[model samples]
Target: MAVHHETAEELVEEVFLFGRALKLAVGNSDSSLLPPALTGVLGMLSIHGECRQTELASLLCLSQSALSRQLSDLVEWGYITRTPDPDDRRAALVRVSDSGFEILERIKESRVARLSTMLGEWSEEQALAALESVRHLKDTFTDQARHASADYTLIAR
Candidate 1:
């Protein structure tokens, strides 16, 4: 049966709620010691390399003050490095630290193991199909987000 837009929205919302709960449980079960926002910042840096504070804040849909607070905490934890932008003395660029990458790797391993156990009953084909569907969703969402951001930027200018 074809899913309607309202059904899709409800399903996505439920998934997000469950995902947040799972993230909290994972955080409590392990010594990873990361907040959701910090994890997001780290993941973005890891994927995108260095980014200006403003750009990162825009991408994260966070206010300047909020992003600054997150960046400060990450820097203090040695999970992120912030350096003055050479081209713009007033701005800073942020990147994930080596320690950050190490922590991410550990977290990834732990999560993967947990998922493996959770999905152990599922056949390989089932797992692959699920992964493929999720990947498609992610890609579509990312592309739309980029387009929306671009439009917002243009309007702002």
Candidate 2:
């Protein structure tokens, strides 16, 4: 039987609601080792290797002072290190430490396991399709946000 448009829309909304609930639940869980902003910064550093503080601040849409405080905390925790940029002695580059990478790996594993358990009944094809759709939606939303406004700030708890 062909799926009705309304049914599909309803299913999409259900999935979105589930995702929101899951995020909130996870955020409240003790197992969440890092705050959202730190997690985001770590993820970006993990992918991009090392970056200057100014660049990171701009990319994360944070003010230099705010980013600096976050960086200070991470450095004190030994999760990341700051080093002088070889090309620019006055500028500093930040990179995830080995400990930080390990933390990221564990976080990725836990998140995958949690999602897989939640989606246990999903077929491989269905999961792949949903993943692709979510990725596309995320990219579209990010692009829209980038062009929409510059006053947005991520409030930290």
Candidate that scores best on TM-score: 1
Instruction: Give, for candidate 2, the lowest lDDT window spanning 10 residues.
Output: 148-157
- Error (Å) of candidate 1 at residue 13 is 4.4
Model 2 per-residue lDDT tens digits across residues 1-157: 9879999899779879977896765533424677767877888888878999998987788999999988897898888999999999999999999998988887777777777787889999999998898789779778888765543543321
lDDT of each: 0.83, 0.82
Best by lDDT: 1
Q: Give the 10-residue window scoring lowest on summed lDDT in candidate 1.
A: 24-33
TM-score of 2: 0.72
Clashing residue pair totals per candidate (backbone < 3 A) = 0, 0
Per-residue lDDT for 54-140 in model 1, tens only?
888877788999989988998999999988999998988899999999878877777677778878899999999988987897898
Model 2 lDDT at residue 134? 79
Q: What is the lDDT of residue 4 in candidate 1?
A: 100
TM-score of each: 0.82, 0.72
At residue 9, give the lDDT of candidate 1: 94
